[model samples]
Target: MKIEVTHPEPKPGEPVGAQYWRSLDEYADRPEFKEWMHREFPQGASELDGVNRRHFLKIMAASFAVAGVGLTGCRRPESYILPFSKQPEGSIPGLPVYFSSSMPDGWDNLPLVVETHQHRPTHLEGNPLYQPYGSGLTAQASASVLDLYDPDRMTSSYRGTRRITSAQVRDLLQETADKFAPTRGQGLRFW
Candidate 1:
């Protein structure tokens, strides 16, 4: 349905001036405008005097926790699970497992908990078990998922301008080891 809005024309001998509207509702008196006028906060921005920012955050957190509790009861759909004669020590076929792990951050290894689906690591969280530091995963830990699937990650070893396979690299290392065998204690390179 199209609603036509017509503005009042100036009286016979009056000079024309700019027309100002307080709001779209004031100009058209729409049903939407009536609804807005009836609300506690007419323009939708409520004055927070009795209810402040802290109280608002608490309410929001409580609501989210309640919703999460409700969702936890739901069951997943049927899927395939490979039967192993002897399953690996920590793995449970259907349930997601959490592993306490860490990543290098300067001098310290930042504590993290990895979430695994089946046998593959899916995401990272904070590890609460370690006594040295309390559990809290950094934003960088969460973003490590991108590195797992990075296309530019080094796949092959290279020597100078020559491309080499793992087998060739192993052979070259063996040759160097043979060359250094006779002088094991006499001379060594470090740094």
Candidate 2:
């Protein structure tokens, strides 16, 4: 549950580097490093200068007992189970079915081969019918499916200080277009 605050967020597909160590023997390939790597652990790890096997086991058992009691006192998570009244004749539960589809991209439509599970679209890929004989999908087309389930995407429009419906936004845009009709946008500059 603890986080290392100093580590930066990694890029999406970047490979991680090896772990850093303080000792030079650990860094360079050394006999001591190999010995440490093959060290017999847990068997004698708890048997330090004072603590013996039985003493360690007793401490561990007590710790586990306390932990188990503490966990039981905490609230158990709630789970839900919903069963369908009737199953479909041909369709099998939990099996995915693929459907050919396409999404608009400017003037063109990118083909999609979507995987649907129990009538729900689960994943998608570029239609194998197009490009390099269905070799791969463009990054834009591949990433577009994520937009379908995006929770943070804007669902409404706002005008100035007030929330406005989509229709009102369209009307306002039209009114502005009319006002700027003959001017050819000479007075306004888009940043």
Which number leads on TM-score? Answer: 1
| Superposition error at 126 for model 1 (Å) | 2.3
Residue 175 accuracy (lDDT) in model 2: 82
lDDT of each structure?
Answer: 0.79, 0.76
Q: Residue 41 of model 1: what lDDT?
A: 74
List residue ranges in candidate 1 displaced over 4 A. Answer: 1-82, 157-191
**Which residue runs of candidate 2 sit more than 4 Å off their true CA positions?**
1-78, 85-91, 118-120, 130-135, 156-191
On residues 135-160, what C-alpha lDDT tens digit does candidate 2 reach at each position?
36667877777786799986778767
Error of 1 at 106 (Å): 2.5
RMSD of 2: 19.7
Cα TM-score per model: 0.38, 0.37
> What is candidate 1's lDDT per residue for 25-110, written digit by digit as tens?
76898988778777847563875668888999999999999989989787897899569988888887789998877787666777
lDDT of 1 at 145: 62
lDDT of 1 at 157: 85
